[model samples]
Target: IRDFPTLMTKARICDEDGKAKSSYYKAMNDKKGKGLDRGKPYENKGNGN
Candidate 1:
């Protein structure tokens, strides 16, 4: 599950403003295979030079 629930299960007690919780869910869905995240970062798609 990409270590999501591992954190969300504690979000209720960790995040007071719920900002971290929201971002976590967004990241889980937006992130693709190979651990590639293209949402907040638009530069990680390097050609591996």
Candidate 2:
């Protein structure tokens, strides 16, 4: 849910339901967990792409 606003914005642009989707997901499952270590950027070929 960290990217909720951005997800909603993108969903609005694409005419999708991001918030409802995330809510449904959260409803069906627990949000607590070890989670991922996001200290580093999720790079994709960097600037050289």
Stretches of model 2 off by over 4 angstroms after superposition: 1-16, 31-49
Estimate, for each residue in 1-49, the C-alpha lDDT of model 2 and write its tens digit.
4689988877686655667787889976774553575444557556775
TM-score of candidate 1 to 2 decimals: 0.30
Q: What lDDT score belongs to each candidate, Candidate 1 first?
A: 0.68, 0.68
lDDT of 1 by residue, 1-49 (tens): 3698778867756666588779888898876454544354545577573
lDDT of 2 at 40: 44
Tell me how far the alpha carbon of residue 18 in candidate 2 is from the true structure, in angstroms, after superposition. Answer: 0.1
Question: Which 10-residue window in model 2 sums to the lowest lDDT?
Answer: 31-40
Tell me the number of clashing residue pairs for each predicted model. Answer: 0, 0
